[model samples]
Target: MTANASVFVEKLRSVVGDKGLVTDARARHPYLTDWRENYLGTALAVVRPATTEEVAAVVKVCAAEKVAIVPQGGNTGFMGGATPDESGREIVLSLARMSRILEVDTIGYSMTVEAGVVLKTIQEEAAAHDRLFPLSLAAEGSCTIGGNLSTNAGGVQVLHYGNARQLVLGLEVVTPAGDIWNGLRALKKDNTGYDLRDLYLGAEGTLGIITKAVLKLWPKAKDVATSWIAVPTPDAAVELLSGAHAASEDNVTSCELMSRQGIDLVLKHLPGAADPLTDRHDWYVLLEWSSTRARREAGNEGGLTEKMEGYLGEAMEKGLVLDAAIAQNEAQARAFWALRENHSEAQKREGPSLKHDISVAVSRIPSFMREGLAAMKKVLPEGRPVPFGHVGDGNLHFNCQAPAGWDKARFMKHGDAISRAVYDLVVSYGGSISAEHGIGRLKVDELAHYRSKIELDVMRTLKRALDPQNIMNPGKIVRV
Candidate 1:
């Protein structure tokens, strides 16, 4: 190590104590690579801070030494936003030790938590208090709230509760210069000035480190009804969603789409997986509706399950749905959701594939899927498309799998061209090349190419103003 780097590590170790600093290569391996193993980086050291004050102190030392800092949470992010670069000069600031639930205000319907708290812990705590924290994802068991806020994560419930950004009411951030911005207000009417909280919420740690957050909560649902429906085409699924909303008074909590190829992969790779419907269809949708009212009271108003059944019956009568199966109980509902959540894992077992997390307007999802699939096929006729995700929110994980008997490496050689073809179509439809996942390192160039001059300039200006030294998560979001 360089003389300056040695001195910087000593200072960081002093602030975090012996247990907080990890310098052994083997111990640091997990933090260096991304979840998908797509990005592998080296860092000077990994530091864990237990409190907001400790985080600020660590940042102060790093800033003084002019060292770049990469604030990492659960490290379950799809993009390489939290991984350090190859230089081995950046410090990996891990928040695992800072996990804590500082406060929970049931009356205000909000909770304040330290950044390191696991998302599932928050959800459980909220439920214990008879409230609900609706921000959920496949990795909620390990992913932290800080990472969710940094990436602006969206999951199955985004159709009802909104993304991580909408669920957060305030934040306590440690600026790049080692100053704390205590904007952790629980007020819902804070229109006082420039909304700094929103700026940092999805900045991917480029501007500052989110140490804590005040998150919004809702009443726990008393009844939840889940259904798996088969549609002849993507357009029919879209039409069915419209009819469901109209019939259920917008109570649709989750609406996910799955292609026949995706389902086949799940059934083949995931043990205990079963086909939810009797007949096979080209496309399918898994949807649910929830109500917080008591079951007896809810039943008096025909209940959420009855309403969902009525909606599906109407959709089937109109030919929007070809077949349907509604879960009879909670166990069955969970079984239906297991198929949707196991998609990523099942695809991993199948083979290496190129994944794209992109979105378009909800109304244009059908057209985007149709056109995007054709564009991708033209690039690689042998590639199989596994297009599925939250159709109600228009975000699709449009992934491409290698054809049978083809080598994974050889198939991946065409990944760039296939991605370009699909992304170009996304741009043509006035859609986002990235939906829930932030830009990180993977989409930096694409963001530069697609974003307008004015938009890029404004982003750069903000980065420079907040982090003049560029010591906080450099080379992320914007290249300022």
Candidate 2:
């Protein structure tokens, strides 16, 4: 290490202590790479701050030294947002040591938590208080709430509870210059000046570090129903969902669309995974509906299950659904969900893949999927498409699995062309190229190219205004 880097490490160790500063190459391995293994970067050291005060102090030191800091929480991001650059000058600021649940306001329907608190822990804490924290995803077990808010994560529940932005009421942030902005107000109707909470929620830590958050919570579900159905086409899936909103009495919690190819991958690679339906179909829908009303024991209508059973029966009669499998118990419901949640892992095991997180108007999903598949084939004829996601919200993980036995190096050669075609199609449909994943280092060039000049200018202007030193997660989101 250089003399300046050695001095910087000592300064950081002074604030967080020797235990907090991980200088060993083996110890810093996990912090340097992303979850997907797409970005393996190098850092001067891995700094673990136990509290917001420590975070602010570390930021102050980095600011004074002009050394770049990569603020990471859980480091489960797909776009390489939390991963540091290859330059060994940057430091990886891990929030793992700061995990804590500060407060649970049952009456106020809000909970305050540290940024490093695992999302699952927060959910369990809220549930113990008879409240639901609806921000959920496949990575909930490992991903932290800070990373979720930083990326403004949207999961299966987005169709009901909205994204992480809507799930939080306030945040406590550490500014680029070490100033603490504690706006952790539990107010639902704050008409304050510029909404800084919204700015940092999806800024991907380019603007500031989210140390703590006041998250909105909802009543726990008393009755729930989950179903895996085989639909004729994407159009039919959309129609099925359009009717489900009312059939379930607006209790539709999630409506995920999966292609046959994706399902086949899960069944083949995932050991415990099984086909919910008998016959193979081109399209499938994993629909869930939950209501706060508890189901009474003695009644012909058991609960959401019976209601959904009737709804699916009608849908089948109308040719909207070809076949279906409704969960009989909670375990069965979880099994149904497991198939959806295990998609990422299954894809990883299958082979090299290109993930496109795009979204459009709900009504336009059918047409968009049709055109998107065609566009993918046009760009890379051999690319096996495995498109699936929250169809109810118009966000699809339009992924392209590599052909048969193609290696990563061989398959990634056509990634750029395929992505360009898919993005152009999404743009033509008035959809977003990035629906949930922020424009981290991976998509920085794409953001510059696809986004309007005015939008880019506004973003760049904000980055410079807040992080004048350009040390906070430098070379991420937008370069100042």
Instruction: Estimate, for each residue in 1-480, the C-alpha lDDT of model 2 and write its tens digit.
Output: 888778888999999998898877787899999888999999988999998999999999989988888999998888999998897888899999989999999999999999999999999999999999998899999999999999999999999999999999999999999999999999988887999999999999889999999999999999999999999999999999999999999999999999988988888888888888778889999999998888875562588999999999999999999999999999998888888998888999988999999999999999998899999999889989999999989999999999999999999999999999999999999999899988788898888888999999999899999999888888887766
> In candidate 1, residue 329 scores what lDDT?
87
* Candidate 1 clashing pairs, residues 3+ apart or interchain: none
Angstrom error at residue 122, model 1: 0.8
TM-score to native of every candidate shown? 0.97, 0.98
Question: What is the alpha-carbon lDDT of model 1 when measured against the actual structure?
Answer: 0.90
Model 2 clash pairs are none
* lDDT per residue as tens, model 1, 424-466: 9999988998999889988888899889999999999999999
Off by over 4 Å in 2: 297-300
